[model samples]
Target: MQRDALSLSQYIVYRNGVPAGARGGLRNMFHRAFGAATFAGFWRHWNPIFGYVLGRYIYSPLQRVVPRPLALILTFVVCGAVHDLVTMAVRGAPAFFFVPWFVLLGTGVVLGRAVGLDLSGRPWVARAAANLAYVLACLAITLAGECFIW
Candidate 1:
């Protein structure tokens, strides 16, 4: 069976689940992501544009061959590689920040899901703080790993 593909605009609207007038603005994205009650939900809300492409082209395909968790990690690593590539081009030097960072975040998602970690019962402020803490902790760990590597 053939699947119907949505245009980027439609995908953004569908992914964000926002009214057409809202257009998934940056502020809305930030609110949804940071306020998400689960790490997976945060990813679902983060950067709908990139998520659409990665979900459709990378993770979906890989999941058919590998396990879902592996696919998720690979998708994140691919995204980080793309970001690193752009940073390298602009800086005229190699950069290796995003890959490990994304890997840790992806792992967090998988483990968090495995543990049934959900903050939905918490206040919105608490949920947002937890999500932000997860992100910053990943960044700090990645920086430490990079320091060891260099």
Candidate 2:
């Protein structure tokens, strides 16, 4: 209750000091379909908790109708589309790399989650690997944006 501090809704949950609401650890609901780690991390990392709406409202329901793989793909597609629209609006031109960027992320989510689910008796490896993969994915997307987004 400090001054200038606003309270978060009860829906907000924390994981390892990071704000990844609603049981978003390695075994959280998001991990099952979205990926074991970092997929939801995009929003979770942001302090305002923007990812909450996307994961809870959009992602949750989408998973019910679509196949798991398709749901996974859709998740990134939604993310990409939103980003693309934002880029178009702000920059007044379509950078358009977000589609492929998010697609690549969806691929990483599937592969990383599969591997992370069972790290051959070493969970830390999966965590570290996932973190590394997320970092690399971000770097790749950023580089692509720099080159393509004019």
- The Cα local distance difference test for each model comes to 0.88, 0.57
Give model 1's TM-score versus the native structure: 0.90
Regions of model 1 farther than 4 Å from truth: 1-6, 17-24
For model 2 the local lDDT of residue 78 reads 85
Q: Model 2 over residues 1-150: C-alpha lDDT tens digits?
A: 221233345334442232344344434433432233444343343333445555665677888998776787787778888889999999998666676777777776676566644433436447557655675876687676777655
| Candidate 1 lDDT trough over 10 residues, lowest sum | 1-10
Q: CA lDDT of 12 in candidate 2?
A: 41
Among all candidates shown, the one with the greatest TM-score: 1
Clashes of each: 0, 1
